[model samples]
Target: MSGALARLLGRAALHAGWIVVVLAAAILGGVCIGETAIPPATVLQTLANRLFGAGYPLDRIDAGIVWNYRLTRAIVAACCGAGLAVAGVILQALLRNALADPYLLGISAGASTGAVLVTVAGVGAGAISLSSGAFAGALAAFLLVALLARASGGGTGARGTGQIVLAGIAGSQLFNALTAFIITRSASAEQARGIMFWLLGNLSGARWDSVLSAVPVALAVTLVCLWHARALDAFTFGADSATALGVPVRRVQALLILCASLATAVMVSIVGSIGFVGLVVPHAARFIVGVRHVRLVPAAALMGAIFLIAADVISRIAVQGQVLPIGVVTALVGAPVFALILLRARPAR
Candidate 1:
């Protein structure tokens, strides 16, 4: 037992270290390859002078390109990727459905709906332009789903899984209708364009302040979820069993739901609706470390960060000079992989 435990820790540490190295290298390489395509040697020279105020001289253009624009965007993508992936992991665990995803509960649709209403209705004004509209939308959808399940008699039983999924599908469609109505009723093409782009997701507008706001919430949620990884494992065994083992199943579920939705909501608000990171990252993590939450969650987060950074790099260069929407590239990559998973996952014996 002692030897086995030691080996597990050693493997976890090794994977975590590799994730860090991959993320760091990707960010550095991406920054150098942005619009100007600065030579790596010049990038190093410019980076040194800009950060430490020392090495070789660099013009303001390169400084703004590296520090102000590209670097900030890459960093934000990494954070968003990790946050969404953790949310996906939590949701999959909570539902005990390999196909369950953060978006399935209607969070994405509701968020997009809220963002659309605000953008269209032009309501409210404040220091913060986005007033948890997306988060409120997400929470509302969550409650709605919970209500749907309860109304359908989905309480603590083996018979409820179908009803739960059915309710989720209904809720998703309802929110989708709401989003479409707002966009369709618009008088001008500009509003339609805005709504369309927002729904599709993009990382072009990543600001330092957005990163500051999102990173803490993301990190906190990830830590909270990690601490509860063991409880999550217990959840896989069913609620009654988990409770019998002294896990506060209800409390843990609520806390995890809030943590995940909050992390995902805030991420959606900032980056719109980048998909696949949350879903694919978790699937990839599952392959890497099986279903152990402690092994799966952190590694999933890292994989997400790396995946999104790499995706963003592709988006940057996909169209030569014009920048493509990062979300488009992610979906293009992610959707097919998801399909493959569904096709290849073995049927229960």
Candidate 2:
């Protein structure tokens, strides 16, 4: 027993250390590898000068590029990645399905619809504006899904797995259709193009205010998730088993789902609906750290940060001067990985 525990600890430590290093490297890479290509030392000095009074003066343009653009973008990417991954973890546990994710739950579709409507209607414009619309849409979707699931499962939050999945699928299709209808009928071609980019997820316009807000919120949500890790682990054995172990199966399900939806909505509001980070990262983290949510949640968050920041970096550099949408890159990567996971877990006929 002691030997097994030691080995597990060692592996957890190694994974945690690597995640930290990767995050640091990613931050440096983000700051230094842009069009300007600032050196790492210069990036550090500029940041130090801003934070501390260590008077190392940099070219104003270089400082602005590092501080105003790349750093902000990287922070936002990390926040989005971490938030989405944890949301996936919570959702997969709540729904008792490995394949569950925010995008799968119709939350992303609802958020996208709301944000698109806000933009199209010219409701608000600025760093902090569209989030309200996105949150509203996400909440609406959550309620719809819950209602549909409950109705299908005899009007209770303790919905059967099949009912919840079906509800999510139906709700997602409905919201997505509504979004398409609104865009096609109400938007100009240019507006439609911009809206499509947002739907596909791009972080090129990320700013410091967004970073400041998103990072803290994402971290807070992750902490909340971690607090419920034991309950989540209980959930893996099915609700009946969990209930036997004194878990409040229904209440826990509702709480975690709501929290996950809120986190997903917040991320989508900032960077548009970047898919698969939530779906793919948690599963990958589970592979590395096992099914225990205590280890899985933090690992997933760190891996998520690394994955999205790396993706953002690739999106920035893949096209000479033009940035590709991050959702496109993630989809290309996630689709094949997801297929592989499903294949590996394919049940015996």
* Candidate 2 overall lDDT versus native: 0.84
Tell me how candidate 1 scores on lDDT. 0.78
What's the count of clashing pairs in each model shown?
0, 0
> Model 2, 1-349: lDDT tens per residue?
9999999989968976986787888788877886557899888988898899688978888888888888899889998999999999988887787767889889998988888778776556544367777877888987898789888763323447667778888998998998898899889999889888878898878897788779887888888888889899888777777899998877888778777877887788889988899999998998888999988999899889888988888888888979899999999889999898888778989
TM-score (C-alpha, index-matched) for candidate 1: 0.88
Give candidate 2 misplaced runs (Cα > 4 Å).
1-21, 122-129, 153-159, 347-349
In model 1, residue pairs whose N, Cα or C atoms come closer than 3 Å (at least 3 residues apart or on different chains), thus clashing, are none
Would you estimate the TM-scores of all the predictions? Answer: 0.88, 0.88
Per-candidate Cα RMSD to the true structure, in Å, reads 3.0, 3.9
Clashing pairs in 2: none
How far out, in Å, is residue 174 in model 1? 1.7
